[model samples]
Target: MSSSLAPGHPQVVVCKWSAELVRSMLDITPHVFVVLDEFDTAYMNPDWELLSRAERVYRISDFDSNEEISAVAADLILRRASIDHIVSFTEFSQFGAGYLEVLLGLTKDPMRHVAFRDKRLMKDRVRLAGVPTANWITLADPSREDDVAAVRETLSFPIVVKPVAGSGAIGTVKVETPDDLLPTLRGIEPDPHLKSDQLTAEEFIPGREYHVDALWSGDTPLYLIVSAYYRPRMSVLDTEPGADADATPPDGSYVVNAEDAPALYSRVTDLHRKVNRALGITGGATHLEVFERPDGELVFSEIATRMAGAWIGAVISECLGYEIHEAIARGVVTGKIPEVRPSRPYLGGLHLRPKGPGRITAIPDEEEMLAVDGVLRAQRLRSAGDSVDHAHPSEWCAFVVLGADTREEYEALARRVCDELRIEVEPAG
Candidate 1:
């Protein structure tokens, strides 16, 4: 058993729904203060032996309500210990984390949390700062014709409509024609928890998409890495049938090649610095997405005030020699940002999603995937007879990490591994 909290140890409060990427944070600190949604307590029960090690835990029945979370956190702080920092890596927990930070007098500007969680607000902040971004409009009433006409006039075809505060590409739709606009809008089911006006319609910039992950101190970037997506996330999210039915599942490959794209790299880093200042991210990790147009123009997509999800941290830790969890912990604990950068030539990773909807009957052997050249790790997310949903990115079943000496070599290995891998599923009855 881990010993009791030692004096002078930073007492970090973590607000989370589950413990996916949270173990490292727990392991690295001696005094942990956990805040969990009451519903997640069941799923987290097995880890109670470990969670009990924390100095304290507060479970709120309504995690979405900032008032409830703040009240519970306030009572916890007053009754038990003084919290040095409030942190959350998950999207859903950001609201509560931010609320707690302000309620406990940790950060003076609470809008940073709002900007980080709300995509609509995030883009507006960047645009206000003179950063180039896709033209966008918020539609409180999807049924309003004036709003639809506004989108047609202000943006080009193939516009993107998504929840104002969504992640993992959930509820995101790409409409290519004005004819499909209203129908697509009607088809979207707004999250009941959000306001009626929380849907955003934005111009979809067609180009190669890339993400910049970095650790920051005020407006200064201590470390950053640029990675390219093998397939745009919308390719996986579009469920309109026809060609999409025959579409291949995403192998989830994102390549980090700073050496080959130094010019674009410089541009993205500069834009990221501007974004951080605009978003008021004084210190912590940030994930920003940008579109490299055909003519080489870079347009801002959106930014998150947390580490990149989708096992990005794992790839970075494996290839760059800096674990994201540790960086976040260190930043939160001591406010000291690590001075580190990508030390590798090229690093790539693949997340395997189900090719179609059905019950998974067979999957490629994990050992075989691991045996592939340049492959570092492989794991199956589902077993035989497990159901697979092909609609959302969250339903993807397997993940593999890789490293290589060059971008071309890494891309080839990633393609071969994805091609050879098989996930067999039987049609639903």
Candidate 2:
């Protein structure tokens, strides 16, 4: 076993408050140590299952700060004499946890983590490294006249305004025209997560969207899966001419097996390798989004140093015959590349979001959702009386994972599930 992972020493996870994470890492180590911020754990309630069973749990006030995270890690080491490893499974905590490792003499410089989370810094690094991405400019304050002029001069229309430090596409929007840019800028409220609500505008790259979920050890990916979205993810931000603004487009993606599309697999893998090199992520799960242009160019979109979300894990489990959620944590702790056992039938998933902002009156149960054909797993995220204010694509209330023999069938089945499944909401007054 690696020095970071001894047989019985506590495996430290600067937790994202995930039960699957605690259970998964426990498989590799006898004891699991979890760290959480008081802010998030209050809402999530870490008293459930595996988290409760952690050998030790540390609650900090400022999880967003690396110093605070490292302090907890340092304190844990003092009490335990030794710790197996340190890692985090969420976007918000990845930097903080990695910094902890650095402080413990396990990792190197921390600028790379900053580059991963800060949109402006991420694009700058990628661009300098000769990676293809949409041209972008950063505004410390979009409300300022100088910053607004810079955007007007530098980026063209239909650009996206994104939070410098954001996750799940929250506080991200598409500004369709130059005339609408100022109004769009004025309309956005301050985001607490971002540093001074800083923004980065990347001129939109037009293409079909895909997300690659991979486990990296050293310079290359040991295991990776590419899945293409059913439609461009940005469509969630789009407004239709005659429809209600909140009428969400059905969201889903089907995995593209390497055997079926060898060329695409090769290209994407190679591109992802370059991205990993440029960005400086050496280990654990990476969820990458990219754009494939009409002329067969792959443009880098964005990446999160965390696992893929929106039922990608369930899709992987259905096709690969294992729970990737826990397997990934297991892989990180034990330093073993996860075994890949590919199974038959093309698989995909649909994310069912609430219709609009409202107190959620009703959400379909697992049994009700499983009535749809070919569904392997149906998960309801919200219940009756649970309120939902769908501001971004990540505000989904349910997930449906399904499979079929052919790619066409997989696509058809995914749509069918979306059309049939319902999230009856009492619309916002």
Candidate 3:
């Protein structure tokens, strides 16, 4: 029997990857041996059922012993002479999980992902490399009330608090005073899995938030895309008003939902070069979040070794007219980047949440929602008969996405669309 499989080989391979964006990329890829490693997490979407044609499927469990995970990895490697590529969609799992692949001797090096999941640790590394980051401190002990006081003393007014290691602004809270502290901390436990060993308190930069999507093709960056986050006009104004009102969530909290804001792509080539050099991030696709303070100071928020989450892979792909996730996969497989270029300059996205409480009965004007100029896609994660509560983490049913030729144009259209679009819901019976 031949020890290796070629491009035309009929053999199949499964994958350990999950996440809607990553799964979409894998589904569209051409034939090759794939090993889908984590079945439990990946199975939430019906997309997994389509992988039945893969060469091998490895169902690994998070609850399994490290020994079991290593064993499964070794088994897959032994069955196939080698894996052509290993790709992940998130910063945490890309390094956390990919390290295991390295331990099984599947990859050239594991050090590439040392900055895996912990946002605090990633910032620490980048800071040591002279990257300008937001004024921040991580809670050494989360359960202690005194540490909350300590956070107040160490930081200025309007501190940004969140789990030290989280993604997509999940579990993130912004508090302006001592009175606003406890409820914000407690409200974040939306899931038991949301718990963290520590929390981060950082000086909330009062300015515009932005992201840079860049791919590390070996020792240099290629196709850098810098995006300016639409300042949540609602959150920025609502922060102080709600602070005086109550500590309840979704209603009285100070956090921006990405879906609510539109992101603009700019050719900030110089800033991209400076940030990449500062972080020493030399491999894979990297997503960097930043806050450009009103004084023109560019303060770093956090940087992920992978693409920005919350369907950002799709946003970048749409804006640039290239497949970034697949490009990352192919680069990992071949150690080279094919010639791909940014096709257009545009702004994209609107993450929406419900304005009032009730079970969503119907979304009456979805076609109208899509009719606005530069509105590429509009979707509501919640459907008819779905109920949403005053929630945290910004995952709500009433959402809309818009794309435009200019950031100003997109924001204007989004505000109008949000006002005009309505979710007819029946009040609690």
Candidate 4:
């Protein structure tokens, strides 16, 4: 590996690894240093060619921590003459990359990144900007009765409890009442991804949920995609009393066409613009989740400064004739998101989970899924012999991206696929 970069190749430090993302970054510059966590490196098993192409690759035990990121930056500063950009393609490493951006004097004002990472700070900034958010109270000490009482006074039953800086729905609990508050909060098992014991309990807003993914050029918007969920994401946390776990309905989202949903597109994009301006979002990508009340008021759920996960990018690429990561890479290099539009009327990814806890006797193969009507792409992450764990609904076994010429056809196709597909599981292996 070389310690110095060739002229005209900017020195870029990538906080994580993605074959396509790294490849795109390297296309513009040979001086790319990739920082990856050991677990991701092992699970992804990136190709040797991509790893070899990067100027340097650092595999540390932890990539999300400030200490680890700072240490790596210090080492890079000592080795290289100058660092141009520190970027993160995933949610977990966004803070680390942004933190380093400021520490290296690449940007000013740490709050810009800190506000995005810390739920409390994020809410504070968003609310101060007059964007409606769930009324929340932070627990300095979840074990302390005083903190719990504060939540009871400020919020109602069925509030949500979550880590101050956590992503996804992991480590989140919905507390129904005062009695259940302490027990639920205490029952949250610790995970390595959880950065702090501090939790925030906020009022739960019930409504249809949707996420907006956008690419921005500084303060201006480049492109935005709005997708509505088939069901509340929090529903994945619990299995219905008698529902079959292995036969659980496909839980996923679909892209909303701007013309098909002109009003929805306007509302979400307008809301996103407000939040983006408030958060100081600039030349990059973001995924914002929001809820629409029954009467049509949009409430803020939370926003992340990274790409949407769960094969969203792939589905978007399949429908839009381009990749979101490609747009992001281009934005990083040229401060612009290339113009791209949806080619299909309806597009979405349907995710399937094991209905019941058991041994998997069978699962549809990729070829079988592709044969289904309107199915454009299919990916099977599990095998016939793999054990089925319904407890974690997020761990989907397979998914298919569906494309259609009309919304009616899209709905029919989704139902047909769900009813036809089967995940045969036995009580024991």
For model 2, residues 332-417, the per-residue Cα lDDT tens digits are 76556556775546888788866567787777899988887788899998998877776777777888888788877776676566
Task: TM-score each candidate.
Answer: 0.87, 0.88, 0.75, 0.91
Q: What's the lDDT for residue 389 in model 2?
A: 74
1-429: candidate 4 lDDT, tens digit per residue:
346656776777877778888888888788888988887778988777878988888877775667887887787777753787666768778777887887787877877887887888888888888889999988878888888889989898889888888777767778888889878877887546666778888998899889888777766667788888877788754653112444434487888888888988887877888888788877577888899999899999899988777767777676557776677777777776556766567898888665677787888999999998788888898888788766444666888888889888887777777777767778864
What C-alpha lDDT values do all the predictions have? 0.74, 0.76, 0.56, 0.78
Judged by TM-score relative to the true structure, which candidate is superior, 2 or 4?
A: 4
**Candidate 1 Cα deviation (angstroms), residue 1:** 29
Q: Show how many residue pairs clash in every candidate, following the order shown.
A: 1, 1, 16, 8
What clash count does candidate 1 reach? 1
Identify the leading candidate in terms of lDDT.
4
Index of the highest-TM-score prediction? 4
Q: Estimate the TM-score for candidate 1.
A: 0.87
Clashing residue pairs for model 2: 4-84
* Local accuracy of candidate 1 as per-residue lDDT tens digits, 1-429: 333457677777877744533565676676777788865776656377677777777777755787788676667555656677677777777777887777777777878788887888899999999899998988766777887788878877878998888887777888999889988888887655454346788988988888788877666666677888766777754432212233332546465566677887789888987888788787777888899888888899988877887757778776557666777777656666456565446776777655579898887768977888777767777888889867556665777788777767776776676677767788887
